[model samples]
Target: MKESHKDIWLKRKQLGRSRYLVLFGLLPWGLGLTVITSLIELISFQQINPVWVPARLVLFFFIGFFVANARWQAMENRFESDSQQRP
Candidate 1:
């Protein structure tokens, strides 16, 4: 049996969502959060704490990851609705 158009469109939309999550959300957020937190300590104290820095970095990275996921979900919902409305 052949696949349907709706199925294909849905698959594409899912892929877009995943890509957005990884590229637009998770990666930059993780990198930015880490850098920002690290810089905060560095600038405030003029020196980085070896232990606390890595911990803070990981925490910030996860925070960014969740924010990205939320953004991607909203985009995905919009795309699905838009596709459904078209002929």
Candidate 2:
């Protein structure tokens, strides 16, 4: 069964959970990027750079946060543009 966008948005808006969900939703993307970058470095150098892994994670964490926030804002706009609830 396919869930409608309104239902998904309602879930996100409920209990103000969207605040955290929006940001955390980017976790998989950030982690995948981090792992890919780290692996590239590992393959090139033939050794793991301990410092870079944590550094990339921290950097991407912040970056992902901002990106997620922007995405959440965009989502709000998208919903507002066409599917706003009636008062």
Candidate 3:
């Protein structure tokens, strides 16, 4: 059976929300892992570069932002398509 525009839109919206939630939830875990890795390096080597943490954080932030933006764009496209299909 073919799905209606409304149904497609709802599904897309749900997917977009889930992607955003996943991104938000994983961000902290990523940061934690970075910190743990940094600590391990520091402990093992007795000298760790201090610039890695900020660079890692900035990279994480930009990646997350890009993912979130992509999901948002998908949701927006679905919304527009749904609206166009309406009478």
Candidate 4:
């Protein structure tokens, strides 16, 4: 535990600051993915289990959401840094 590990404090980890999450931009993307994927699944449901259908919908949406969000976050940070560097 960090509390007990006195040595840990001596050699403090040089971890980078955590990401600054901007929910305003990311929320729409996440919800959009959820809605779009769910609509696609609406076309058919013969193969997938009824219970798993919602689960799959949720999974696909979240995967798309997180992946897109991460990429978007990186791009946002890059653009910000680029803008700051411009004279």
Task: Summarize candidate 1's per-residue lDDT along 1-87 as a digit string, tens digits.
Answer: 123755654665667766756666566877776777778989999987889866766776677668877765665676677767777
Question: Which residue pairs of candidate 2 clash?
Answer: none
> What are the per-residue Cα lDDT tens digits for candidate 4 across 4-50?
34244223222211221223223454566556556666657524346
| lDDT score for candidate 3 against the true structure | 0.66
Model 2 scores a C-alpha lDDT of 0.69
- In candidate 4, how many Å is residue 59 off? 1.1
List the pairs of residues colliding in candidate 3. Answer: none
Q: Counting only residues 3 or more apart in sequence or on different chains, how many pairs clash (N, Cα, C under 3 Å) in candidate 2?
A: 0
What TM-score does prediction 1 earn? 0.66
lDDT of model 1, residue 19: 79
lDDT string, candidate 2, 1-87, tens digits: 124876776677663645654445447556867898988988999988888888888787777777767766776787776554444
Q: Estimate each model's TM-score.
A: 0.66, 0.68, 0.47, 0.43
Q: By summed lDDT, which 10 consecutive residues of candidate 1 come out lowest? A: 1-10
Each model's lDDT: 0.69, 0.69, 0.66, 0.49
Report the C-alpha lDDT of model 3 over 9-68, residue by residue, as the tens digit: 576567666566455534754575567778998899897798888876667666666666
TM-score, ranked from best to worst: 2, 1, 3, 4
Best by TM-score: 2
Candidate 3 or 1, higher lDDT: 1
Error of 2 at 64 (Å): 0.8
